[model samples]
Target: MLALLLAALQAAAPSPGPAPSPQSPSQIAAEAPAAEWVDITPNDLLVMELAPAATGRPRRIVIQLVPPPFSAPWVANIRTLARARWWDGTSVNRVQDNYVAQWGDATEAKPLPDGLLTGTEAGYTTQLDQQDSVVAGHVEHTLTPPITALRRADGGLEVDPYARGGVGFVGGFPVGNEGYGSPDTWPLHCYGAVGVGRNLSPDTGYGAELYAVIGHAPRHLDRNIAVVGRVIEGIEHLSSLPRGTGALGFYERPEERVAIRSIRLGSDLPAADRPRLQYLAEGGATMTRFIAARQNREPPFFIRPAGGADICNVPVPVRAAP
Candidate 1:
């Protein structure tokens, strides 16, 4: 009877399958089906034209505005400013090393167009769709299970130093929440992120003055400032500019500032001039593969996989629309 039982147990054991092949993040993204890519609406695109580089190459930066339900008032003001051509003739006034590249009226005297609304400090964070319950004065987020691609293989949320709820892509932008199940979610300050320049509290920026993070990801600035958009293309134009000599990276001399030719919404541009772009959808199968590959480095250049990746390190893949 013992011999029979042993034979049965051995038969019941499952056969082993082949080990999965390793793939790099870019490889996974390239292999993704076209259907996994989502088109960016022209109306939501902000195109800024800077003066040509010394090499005479045209310099154009494409910015994708955060979708509605986040920074609504500031977004509205940005649209208004663009329609009125308010940023024309303005200059990039600051280029702080390992920080940001700022622009607007360096004179700080540009008259904002009419109908531009002032954003309040409260607008900095958007309430989460998921509700929170208070337990002993501590808020507990009741997160729904595994909604994003940025989850561990066993369905655990990725860890983030800046967000207790952890970080994930929201509308193709990296965002953090209070907890995995927390009630508040806000956009992040990853490199190439664009935000409004404000003086101090109670004075949220009106979107007239803007800055693009050209250095390290300033996670500390996450919920403190209004992150209006991000540089989807031509970021090198801003990142490679000379560092500012004045305080806070502001140019000390007027001649040092880089001039802005124009800033316009893609919808306002002619069909021939408008740019069409797309990003991998956050919950798509391709995005899941991409995230996994990013967390685990493969064997071409690396001998050992890192096992984990920073939220900012896993940038969503954005490319020209096919």
Candidate 2:
């Protein structure tokens, strides 16, 4: 009887499978080596404070500016605006459902600070320094030096629905280009991307009016708008806002606007107040694993790994500095 009881207990116990792997993307990122992390300087951070929520919770959004070699003029203008306190007392006037949340001087009467750069429509894309040469029976190309590492598979190329050539991470941002060796590269409109609002085609925005993508990845807007930065923290403050009723999601009533308390560069804040953040280095082993994990979800939850992923789906991992 004791042996029978022991056998029943053993039968009821679940069998262990291969030690469960890092089943999620977050787990992969958590296991990344410390050396594979990259720090975000305070100067590159744009800190925007919104009026507290109904619950009285302070809402602060931290935006990390796109580094050099892309959107230079707009980024510079944003820095200047932050330093000049240009966005103080502004308001988010638009909250398009599955689109964007825009903020600026709603009155449209506030004067922009001096030294704002007038970026051209051409500034929408950065032309990489491309030099093609054949090396060892392979078409080798030397492109611009990358600021943010990129994941290059099969000679730096990946399938993309928007970009005929391909899509990949460049300078830590998702960029679509003609091909692996294409000279023209433009930032993508992924969720949380911060972009300059402009008039018609002729007027590239000078960084005064800004919007954050709060919905799906609007790939169609790529190369048509200037993506200067991405919201690294507190995106929920913008994404969870009430949608606008007016045309194009602009708030019809003035009372509908969400007020902006202040916008400042992180560098201007006191050391303790400054946000210290970091991103997992792209092209690093850990990032590769993270992307793979995202593409192919493992056991416990997902039944079948998709075996593929959208470029936007594999966003780089950012975290508060340890």
Candidate 3:
């Protein structure tokens, strides 16, 4: 099973595509690991809820993704695999500033005594934002990802077929599409988004591996990877890690990579595990106020507003229920 999974992952992103658009090498880092399913739909049962720290007070945060003139968001529910299981929380291990903030076991640290998957890798893997694809022989999963983003200032969104765009928000999710102006919704690979991991192959993952976004906006990657979810909380932990000096920006030494205490699904947690929380409503009045505040942030850092905001700059807001 592990051998088959590994082969499948290699087939997806076979180290060849037209010259990558000038998005960023960081785009490569934001790349996703493979999963059994290429698509995440209403049928797939999953919902991401932010769990707070020892502080007791809910670690409230505003998701920085939705477009302006809208701020408050609502809670979102993702379909699970029908049957439920608990997944634990993993620690952030690698940190590369303005690039990515990653955490999880590189390979399953725990060796399955008899190899449960029979032929597959075991427990050292944890979920991060997106897996970085290497140039030489590294493979990526084949994803017909659908991006949802706001059109450019001219009312036209990214139309280049080599890339993808539709530009919009769903709940707290950022997405894009293949058919322009059509009703298709795939995942968007915005900064800090989370996805499963795989080796140099496709469908070789089982949703255990994951990564996070931490750099430039890599829009061209839409519909090309499996976007599981975003880091609804605790980004600072990963973002503040030391930068890697390695070629593809990996931590130079093993010790530099952070550690994962454990990573599990919120559902898997005990009754005390469920954290009380609420996401700001995109259409709510508060969102409208927040949009204006960011779009025209009179911050001391800026002497001038870019006068326009990119979809990547938008923040999906979350806060404790008042």
Candidate 4:
């Protein structure tokens, strides 16, 4: 009887399959069907033109603002700033190595540009309050299984990477949300993320000063600062700037700052000049495969895959629209 039972157990065991082939993230993205890509709307684009230094070539940086239902207030403020040309004369005042490159009225004394709606600052505070209330109300709310299940279904495993609950994307921007079910989500401070700079008071920042993450992802700043957008193109213009010699990456001398010629909404520009961009759609089969590829590095560069990917590490791919 014991011999028969042992033989039956051995027979019941499943046969192992061949090891899965390794794929680079680029390959996975390239293999994604065209239907999985989404075009970036002009309304969501901020085209910033910087005054040329001795280089004589004005740098054009394109930033994609987050859509509504997340960071709406701050987004509104940024749009207002752009529309009012608030950043037209502002300059890049700080460039910290492996940190952020900040730009705005370094003096912080410039009056809010004309045409900005009255009580804009108050509106920002109110919106933040509303967002916080919503988050608080849903703190205990839970539903659905974690993203691990989805990852598993896609032949991948969750390594619990990133400091946030579950990292994903909303409207093309990488977002950190409360696991599988909750609505609590915030834009992550990944490399090239553009955030509003503030003072000691959280509500003080009214979208005047903005900074881009130039180094490692500062996950600690997530949800703490108002991250309104991400640099979709020309990040090298800011990232490759000279590092500041002053404290906190501030240029010690005003002469060292880089000037901004103008910051315009892409929609405000002529159709011929508007940037045509497309980003890989999130929450699709292609995105899943891309994330998996990132999590599992292939053999040439990595013998042992980390089997995990941080939200910041997996930047959503963007390119000029073909």
Candidate 5:
């Protein structure tokens, strides 16, 4: 009876399976079906043309604005600025090493152009004044609460391997969570993230001056500043610029700054002039596969896969629209 039981137990044991085939993030993305891709609309696109300086190559940077419920005030302000051509004459004034590359009217003397709608600077106003404005026939921009973190089955919040807090995505933007099911959600300060510059006051930034994270992800700034959008294309143009010499990476001389030729809303451009871009749908099957592949690298080059991935480490792939 003992011998028979041993034989049955051995038979019940599963056989070792073949190792998972090595798959890179690019390979996984390429294999994704067409339905897994999302097209970017013209209304959400910002096309920025930079004049060529010593580099001899003109730079064109494309930014995709976030949808409503997050940073609505700042997004509206940026659109207003673009329509007024407020950034046309502005320059890339700051490039801090291992930090951000900022561009705008560095002198801080440019007047708010005419035809801008009200409530754009509501962030800088007193709470009582803001309430009064809303009550007194002023149209208020509605901001949606974002889903920033996720709760686990055990009633604890999930934490990524990098320990940067629980992270997720909303409308394709990476978001960090305060806690599982928390009402507050803020965009992550990942690479290529575009943020508004402000003074000491939290609401002082009016989208006139903007900066892009060109170095390591600064998660601390996630909720402190308004993250309007991200650089979808030509990030190299901004990231490769020379580091500024002045305090906080401001250019020491006016000539050191790169001039902005123009910034136009993609919707305003002709069909042929509009930028074509598509991104992998977040939380979809394709994205899941890509994330898994990145987490556990099976390639021979990697002797041991980390078996995990950071929020910033997993870059959402983007490509020209077909």
Candidate 6:
């Protein structure tokens, strides 16, 4: 996993927070979870169990998610599980220069056994039709000061402004949640981000096979599909794979393509089999230092300071289970 994340490594540029638009009664009530969400807001550090069953007592991991806006926040004691069953037959579909790395079974392959979304909701299918869709439509628009400020095409993720797939950021993960109203949220080709290769049809992602972004953040693929997970560690393994010569970056030689041994959810594994992981809740000293360090470039390589920082440039560090 670490190898893949390093290679693939890789959003919510929405309206400014602090003053939520007066939500309707239902909307207000629906926000209870967001409110009760254990306050994972940026800057705050909360410890989450890497694997609830990994140990007799939950093995702890420590890391901070750069508060609100930065993608790829700091991580510690986190392990990427072996790749899981994704759109099985899908192959890497498209790869553009300094843009994105996409994959799917464009050959019109069928989903491998035991790897398809069973229903419209639940499981990793995480339908955007919930309280907060993956990419909220309003947030996509309403580019205001300090909000929606990420460098993106005029239209948001609904349609690829670059006329590719889509591009944008959702939370810390760079994605283009296009067609978000009807709620079309799929993974885009963001560094370290993952996507199930598919064909022209949207529903092609049966979650049997998947791919990780090997290059630049492909903003054009935003909101185009569902992005279930990301490279928490070892990103380089997938990213460094030799470029494929087939239709969509497919390896010209079979040996060139990295082989997938197997994939299973950490939760599904036995106590002994599970990998440890911890997602640092946002808002904490870790982030404070990170943000400041990023803004000023104080590490002292050259002595030039950025004066300001964009959400994309910062990365949340991931490490071993503490």
> Which candidate has the highest lDDT of all?
1
Q: Summarize candidate 3's per-residue lDDT along 190-258 as a digit string, tens digits.
A: 677754445653333444444577777555545444455666566665565567787655677766655
TM-score of each: 0.87, 0.87, 0.54, 0.79, 0.80, 0.49
| Candidate 1, 111-204: lDDT as tens digits | 8889988778878887766442111111122334312526665577787778887778767788787874556778889988999999878788
**What lDDT does each candidate get?**
0.83, 0.82, 0.42, 0.73, 0.74, 0.37
Best-to-worst order by lDDT is 1, 2, 5, 4, 3, 6
Positional deviation of residue 25's Cα in model 2 after best superposition, in angstroms? 0.5
Alpha carbon deviation, residue 77, candidate 4 (Å) = 1.3
Inter-residue clash pairs, candidate 4: none
Candidate 4 lDDT (Cα, 0 to 1)? 0.73
Report the poorest 10 consecutive residues by lDDT, candidate 6: 70-79
CA shift of 65, model 2, Å = 0.3
Cα shift from native, residue 170, model 4 (Å): 1.2
lDDT of 5 at 17: 85
Local accuracy of candidate 6 as per-residue lDDT tens digits, 1-322:
9877665643323545575343332332233333222222222221222222324444332222222221211111011212333422333344444433454345444434332233122221222334442222112222211122133223232333532333333443443333324343333344665544444643444443445555766554544543444565555434443465666565565434333323334444466644454332123334434444554544235366655544444443333343
Off by over 4 Å in 6: 1-111, 118-189, 201-204
| Residue 213 miss distance in model 5 (angstroms) | 0.3
lDDT of 4 by residue, 1-322 (tens): 9999999999999978777777778878877777777777888899999887476876999999875555666777788888888888889999999999999998888889554422223222112112232211112112232121224334543443442355556567666654443445566788999988887753547778889999998878876777778999999899999999988999999889999999999999999999998778766788888877777777867888776766677788876777
lDDT of 1 at 143: 33
